[model samples]
Target: MDILYTIGAVLIFAPFIAFLLVVLIARKKMKYQSIGLAADLTTFLLFFSVPVSIKAIWEIDITALVYLIAILIAIVLLVIEWRQTKEIEILRYIRQTWRMYFVLLALAYSSIWAVGIVLSLLHFFRI
Candidate 1:
């Protein structure tokens, strides 16, 4: 059970871990980016599966806070990407690739957090 919990945690955070590795450490290496994206997709699946995996898991209720935050962040990233696309010609090399990866990362993170919140609620209710 402890090992299962540990593995669940890892699955939940895999995207963030991969993103950090690819962005900070790998420095845009194509191979690394591909691996990171794959991990991120897995993270998405794990996130969606949380309720099924944990018998006590329940749906989260968050009004629109998460959506609002995600919209704000997406807008900010879009602006930055737009500026970079205009100013740095070489940015074209990474623009589409980076944008795709960024969107995937954001989605994976948000989904997992939502799932975690639901799981927390389930635990609280002892369901």
Candidate 2:
């Protein structure tokens, strides 16, 4: 039962994790290659799966903490990347694209949160 719950959580939150990694960390590379994007997305999914699974098993209230930490880390990384790679044109492009990325990420997060809430309500009502 625990394992199944873990898997479900992982399957739920995979895409948002992928978007975070590719947008925040890999955006500075010169290549902007497809392989890098795939790798980051894979890594994001893998890491995200584990934590979500653990949370499901433990019944943790991590909603605020997770978003807070993610937003803080994202801001820090963006500031650091901007400061360190000011001369790179790719970074400029990444900065421009980040707006779209955030919008998509917000939409994904909201959808996931809504689904989770609905599921929890259903479970509570024994539906």
Candidate 3:
């Protein structure tokens, strides 16, 4: 239980670190794609597990379900991207425009973490 929160908390930073690494050091390489993908998955799992822990200790919030669905969507997108293994039309275009993909994921994941921080603080202070 406590460990779940700890892992979840730690995982919350994974995506940010990955994003920063990609933007700062690996911006010129295709490796950013794998790093971003790993970060996104970590972010998804963090949210997914946190909600489960919260539910075990307290009543489940509506927002938990929303987060679960969002994680599922993220996972689906990752799978769709992964299944482009052969790099056909759309996949080839996506691979070619990897920068665009990284930018969008960065924006989305950063905003998610930002909102989570705000909401956590609000809840902590009972504001």
Candidate 4:
């Protein structure tokens, strides 16, 4: 159980590394498959990393905040689509919301890492 927990924690915290490893393994099997695998893994990893990244950089737990924001985004998108098309499209709403989360989370993850790296380097140089 302890080993399982350790592995899970590592995967959760080091999503980008895990993503690369998975992509490389998939690539060895099939080039086309790897492309799709990479896309899927990126989104999946972002879901875990977004909250972890936000917490690391901000020193605040944003796990619940991310979910709340996602719900709000879905609501806003549904309203706009309904007003324009005069219909409720569940599938389209899901796709748009998912893609939005992926884009936003990817940006957050990368930016947080960039800021962390910069801060670390600055601190190291100061000493």
Candidate 5:
């Protein structure tokens, strides 16, 4: 059970690691976006599976905390960009460029927490 939680936490945090690697190594826009997309999608599925298997939930788990932190980081990023630009231009640019990734990440990120909560509700469920 603890191993499952640790593995899930690692998967959830893997996107941040991928982001750093892409920035430091690839330095290619496409590569960075690809890594982000792949990580979010993979972690989304990985988190989705464990709860389904255990038929239970773990309360106050690291995976849920990681998801929360991810959401907060995203909110901070958007706020910083908006504050810096002080216009709709950045939004328009994101809409034109990384909109799909942004949308998917948002959905997947939210879903991870929801799943965690529901899985946590079941008695004796150790995710």
Candidate 6:
């Protein structure tokens, strides 16, 4: 149990490693490049990990806030799709929503790391 938690913590803290591992595993099964598939998987992984990472770095849990933002974005996208096409395409909507979440979460993950690095530097310098 402790080992499992340790591994989980490592993966959560180092999502790039997780991403690379996914790509490597996916490549074994795929003849073509697996970057896209790996990215999608990493994005899904980020959806869960980003909030935890943010909490760890900032000492605040924003899981509910993050989820609420995703939902709101999806709802807005759905409305736009409905207005443009005049019909709801479930499959397309789902794909678009997923892509949007990937972009959103990826940006959040990068921003969190950047801010964390800055904070660490400031603390180290006693700034």
Per-residue alpha-carbon lDDT of model 4 for 47-85, expressed as tens digits?
A: 777888777767899888888987888888888988998
How accurate locally is residue 27 in candidate 1, as Cα lDDT from 0 to 100?
48
Q: In model 5, which regions exceed 4 Å deviation? A: 1-40, 46-60, 88-127
Which is the winner by TM-score between candidate 3 and candidate 6? 6
lDDT of 1 by residue, 7-125 (tens): 66665545455445445644456655665555545545443343333333334544254345546665666678677666544455345444554565466456666877887898899
Estimated TM-score for each candidate: 0.33, 0.36, 0.36, 0.73, 0.30, 0.86
Error of 6 at 93 (Å): 1.5
Please estimate how well model 3 matches the true structure, expressed as its whole-model Cα lDDT.
0.54
- The residue-by-residue lDDT of candidate 6 on 82-111, one tens digit each, is 999999999889878887888888888999
Given candidate 4, what's the lDDT at residue 83? 93
Task: Indicate the TM-score of model 4.
Answer: 0.73
Q: After superposition, how far is residue 127 of candidate 5 from its true place, in Å?
A: 28
Extract clashing residue pairs from model 1.
none
Considering TM-score, where higher is better, how would the candidates rank from best to worst? 6, 4, 3, 2, 1, 5
Clash counts for the predictions, in order: 0, 0, 0, 0, 2, 0
Q: How many backbone clashes can be found in candidate 1? A: 0
lDDT of the structure predicted as candidate 1: 0.54
Best by TM-score: 6
lDDT of all predictions: 0.54, 0.56, 0.54, 0.77, 0.53, 0.85
Reference-based lDDT, residue 43, model 4: 70
> RMSD in angstroms, all models?
8.9, 12.5, 7.8, 3.1, 11.1, 1.9
Q: Encode model 2's per-residue lDDT on 25-105: one tens digit a residue.
A: 655673466445644455445345434643664566555665565566566766776788776466654544444344444
TM accuracy, model 3: 0.36
